[model samples]
Target: MKKLLCIVLCLALASSLLFACASPAATETTDAAATEATASEAAATEEPAATADEPVTITILRPGDEEKVKSFLEPAVQQFEAENPNITVEIMYESWAGWIQTYPTYFEADTQPDVIFWWDNKLYDSSAHDHLVNLSNYLSEDFFSQIPQGIWDLVDTGDMDGVYYVPNSVDTFVMYYNKDVFTAAGLDPNTPPTTWDELLTDVQTIYDVTGTPGIGIPAITGSEVLEEFVGLFLNQATDASVLDSSSMPLFNTADGLSALTMVQNLSKYAQTSPTEYGRGELRALLRDGQVGIIFDGPWAVPTFKAAYGDDLDNSPIGIATVPLAANGKKIDWAGTNGWIATRESTAAASAKLIEFLMSPEILLSHHIIYGSAPLYASEFDNAAFQYDYWKVFYDEAQNYKLYGMIGRNSATPAAYYTALEEVWQQLVLGQISAEDAQAAAAAAAEGVTARNN
Candidate 1:
């Protein structure tokens, strides 16, 4: 009876041990199922696909007409967006009217765009502030190497200072002439007048043969007036010495009087009284072949091209460097406008956009459409930018000079420009002598400096 009881006890103990071992396996299986269910729920809700709720957008503020933006900028933006699926570009246009008043307000409000198109005017002054990004640290050395060292020097304020802007286009003056008119005048259309004296002779010949005026220069008091006397003729005479080293007006001198006298002499061959012609009228007269020559900027190429078609390059119309001085020295007055990224922007992304826009292919296309000289050095070598009309003025970019105010400490040029304009109109109308014009210009500049002080 004792042996039977012991065997039952042993069997019970073995069963208990087996059940304890099995309990851990069952718990582990249940935990595995729970973890799988939790993972399934997480997969179902895993943050909804990137939608309108979250978008990465870059904004650019530029100044231009809608037609221009649609024609040139929109396509480029579209390509950028297409390539960068996670990013979008929004372009906002500032109106041409009152833009100067409106642009600075954005910075004041701390609402400037990620990228902006700005001129050298007052930008160098602005660079002293913290409003602009320090591009020296952000841009790679290879990128800066692509642009001319002179241009980099043009924008650089100092050795430690940053490059606040990247130039997109450069502009300079050139004389456009009707080759057909030159040919009719018994002058070789292929050989343009190389000196001021030669230009005068050619003008007389064109007048004698064609019975039309030799040249059309704006004599009206406005921006064109200021540009002709102060922008072009003044610089040509003084070798871009419009201002003294001390940043004082230097145009009230013998050189300045000489420049004015030259302008006066040229006026005798004008198609109409300088007062009677505006830039538009002159361009129209030139287009209709009513005038032999007109001094204008590079921006007018498309207008001339449209009027003359293949003849623009073939022969009917041609571009020439402004006639040289007797000493064989020539200087071109130029202005540069460029893209600036604000300190408030995403500098990395804004820089990328500039890099993309300034690429050889993109810049070439933009310059082709805009009719301005390309900002990059290599772009000059590109055949697309080498149309005959372009080459005539394009090479001059190498030897070009910027406006007086391009320097860091130069005074406000526009302040005196109005007075200069009034003086120019008087001179062109024979109301004021060259010496008188210089005196008046000096007084005007003095008044501006006094007011600032």
Candidate 2:
């Protein structure tokens, strides 16, 4: 009996050991299955990354000389593509003249490039405002903070609530003169005009002595050239903007009359058929020594450099701050152009590309190649910006009371050109008095308020 009881005890101990070991194996198998199921569910829900089979192609426009633009842009595009294998970027090159004429048509067709190098003041001029993406939606606060607050304020026209443009070029006007012309006029080449009276005297002296046109006046209608040319003097005389924020004429005062009168006086010595020239033509005239003086932006630097070589300040081309008006504060007209993304579908990719372009190295390179003043404070240290002529521009940008274009903040940004084009042409042609021009400008402003507001 004792032997049989011992045998039963042994059998029970063996069964207990087997059940403990089997229980652990079953628990581990169940846990493994649960983990696999969870991973599979997560894979089903998560968004997929872009792949070779599903590539995204985006187009961006770089408006300039085709060969010059392609020289820098093509390599940059290749680098961007290599970094982002799934994205293919196409660059559309258009000359400045051609782009200006065709940009409106681009919006009409809904076939605008995904991203465009755009004019800041003209943001709301056409259907472009509707198509532009509010970059604030996609870019982070850190990204927006990269630019100065002043620049942000300048670009924020209050047309809409969000940022629509990323300014890459913040340009102000400067007086460009030909030293050869000045020397021939019996004037010191280094002593350019500093006041409206002095400018008038210099113009008369140059024309009298050298027989060259004292200046090239860009009075071409249907373009912003005439508007900018007159507006700069208006800014100098009034020390204020020509149009109020509401697009009302602010230049109908006595000071405004004087400014227009000065413009008319200066027109007498300008190249014949002043209406035939635009800013670009004026630059060419300056280059060829046909005109003694003209107001232009830093964009003329590269061309002048090519014509005059590396030392532009010492070359025949001379740059100075825009001449001031009597009793006028140091003021000048400023404008900006930047990148704008138009397509909502390509916003992400466009933003990525913009961020890449705005990187310090790339942006500096762009400023150098495009002959723009350094947009960032950090860029001032670059060797490319170290030229003497750049200081005049940089000073104007930093120290001057800069006003933007007329109607820049209004719904009808192009009102300045539309309303004043004919009268301005008449004023420049000496067919109308300055008082008449002022009255016509005021009426045009009124028309803009009525039509747009």
Candidate 3:
């Protein structure tokens, strides 16, 4: 009986030990499952897709008709949005009218633009001098390399002989002529006039046959229309950098006088007085075949296409280089507008956009659509663009010079150009000779220097 009781006790102890071990193992699995469930829930809830509830707006300022801009630019913006889901671009159209008034006020205030298109010369230099952001760090080296050479040079302030802005396009004069107008008038459409004398002769021939002036120039009130036309003449005769490098007025020279006189003497054959050739009127005249030739930018190409097509339905138009001087020299004035951040506001995001905009693909698009010369060698896609017009500009871009107030100081240039504007108007109107105009310009420039220094 004692041996039997001892055996039962020993069996019970072994069973008890086995049960304890199983209990611990079961609890561990439950804990692991609970922890894994919590982790899975967290992983599922971590990232949320973007919703319309959040939208960011960035602004850009550019030129040309708002309607025209929207038709072309909206698509490009949409393309950008596909890649940058977080960003939205809002475009604002700026005009030459009261531009100075509008731009400075917006820039100086705390509410600033994320990016904008700006004239890189005197305007940018002034912005830089005021301690606005410098975009040098943000713009990439590849982007810098993509800019056409002359276009990039225009943005350099020549302060430290360094660049402050990133140029995007080359804006300059090009010739627009009515194909139907010339054809109907028995003029050869195959040849475009290259020299000043030939241009006048063609106009004379057109008028003799059609009773309409062959060429039109705006001698009237606007600064841009008058100044650029005059600049072309100055450029053809001599180096335009004389004024910029020397900071002196050279308008009295034979070159300047000849440039001014070329248009002044053309008054008899012009369709309208200088003041009469405002943009609105010019567009109408060019389309109607009342005026045969005018100097314009790439911006006009699409407009001509829409209105005229390849036929004279609206009177077909053709593009050519701006007419050269009587000396047979071509001097086309080009303006390169670029993106600039004030020194204080230069940011990484801004540079990233600049980098994107400066890519070869973007530049090629810019060239084909905007008529800017290609900045990259690969962008030539010569087969696609299929126009010799690009070469005319590409060749000229290498030699052309940019003008404007671009020094360490902006106030002097602002004031000086304002004064020179008056002198320019007087010269264009034939109220003063080149000599007198130069003296007035000199006096005004000297006054600004003296006061500022």
Candidate 4:
């Protein structure tokens, strides 16, 4: 009986060992199956495409003014960044000294900024049309619904068939007079010049009475200087197409001579060696109260206000619509400074950045701080825009069919503007006759047209 019991115990021990080994294999198989199923479920579920840890960087080019950026642009960018934590904005501020030459180079190279601050009239035709993306197809309908029709109409001009640029602000050259200078000259500062004759006579009066230069004209070799002529005269002329259908000079006519003569007459009372000053330097002369009148854009309001403090609206300075044309007309050049993007850029990200910049809240804030006229019609009702000077600008923007140096619905060769500036410098310096300047400009334009063809 004892032997039988031992055999049974040994058999039970063997069975227990076998059960233990089999249990481990079964458990391992079940665990492996559960892990695989869990991983497959996770793979099928929708997850956030991007996380805060992995962010995209969007680069942009903007002319830098630290104070101005701090006052407005920087804050707007901060707001954008806060809203879009997954995206970053890298801003590079190129100086005007080399910007004109360097800006075009950016597109030629493989590394270009995702977005660029382009002058709607200046670079829109040349840089934007060729290199940038046509945004009309990508922009949402709600975006178009927010902007004014007239503002959008200006974008689709000449060979630019689609909306390739978005204008942040609209501006025109207006007459900013130093009221103190006017008062010192015993002239009524309240009554700004209405006619070209009045403008010249007032300038001469300021010179004769104040012993300071009556006006400071930007006569340098640039499109800004040419726009002075176009703003002051060409818009008033009967047919102001500076470039005809074929991009040839059309300004050498009788109206052209007359415009040159008007500028030449005013030059006599202008700061000596006016060509020595660029627009910003010339504006500085006005800011220091050395010049009585300055033909500048609304973009300069911040500087003017910064210089004169509380007296910006009266006593020291006043803003007026640009002097009227000889035929009792009021027309001038205007620009909608644009935010343009490149075709090679990450379109989704770049478009979002543009939409952020042009958003009504940010744009209106910029206008309020920088004094640029807003493109959005909703901005017209802001309390900040109720000032008389702003009213003058708004009236001109609404009434006059303003164009940039390269007229509305038209484009000009870069050489044409270059020639106009050279001719204007000579004309202002007493080195060339109005007729001669006109002739030289037309001839240079003809050469440019031929070369382009």
Order of models, best TM-score first: 2, 1, 4, 3
| Model 1 agreement with the true structure over 1-453: per-residue lDDT tens digits | 899999999999999999999999999999999999999999887633333224566788767776876677788888877766666788887665656667657777877777877765555344224577766666778888887765654553433366778887777678888887888889898898888789888888898788888988786655634445345677777775565533467777677677878777776677766777777778878887899998877777777777766346775777888887555666766666788877533666677678778777788888877777666656668765656667666666656554433233333545555666787777767788878878887787667666756
Q: How many pairs collide in each candidate, listed in order?
A: 0, 0, 11, 0
Best by lDDT: 2
- Candidate 4 lDDT tens digits, 1-453: 999999999999999999998998999999999999998898778432333345778787766565665666567778888988878888776655566677657766746687877776654345445677777766788987777565665454566577778877768778888887898999998898988889999999999998989988887665456445543576576446566656677677787778878877888899998778877887788777799998878877777767765336664778888887677766776767778877543556677778888888888887886678756667767776655667677777767766565533333445666766777788888899878877887897777777766
lDDT of candidate 3 over 136-209, digit per residue (tens): 65556766665656666655465544455677777667777888788978878768787787777888777778
Which runs of model 1 end up more than 4 angstroms from their true locations?
1-56, 81-87, 124-130, 153-160, 228-230, 244-247, 375-386, 400-413
Name the TM-score of candidate 1: 0.78
**Which pairs of residues clash in candidate 2, taking residues 3 or more apart in a chain or in different chains?**
none
Leading candidate by TM-score: 2
lDDT of 4 at 355: 86
Q: Per-candidate RMSD vs. true structure?
A: 13.3, 10.8, 14.5, 12.9
Question: What local distance difference test score does each model get?
Answer: 0.70, 0.84, 0.62, 0.73
Q: For residues 1-453, what per-residue lDDT tens digits would candidate 2 score against the true structure?
A: 999999999999999999999998999999999999999999989655333335789899989889878876888888889988878899998998999778889998988898888887777776677898877767767778887666676675565878788988789999999999999889999889998999999999999998999988988868887888899988888877787767788889999999999999999999999888888888889999999999989877877888888788678999999988898578888888889998776777787788778777778888888888887778878877777888888788877878776666665677667778877889999999999999988897788788876
| CA displacement after TM-score superposition, residue 10 of candidate 1 (Å) | 79
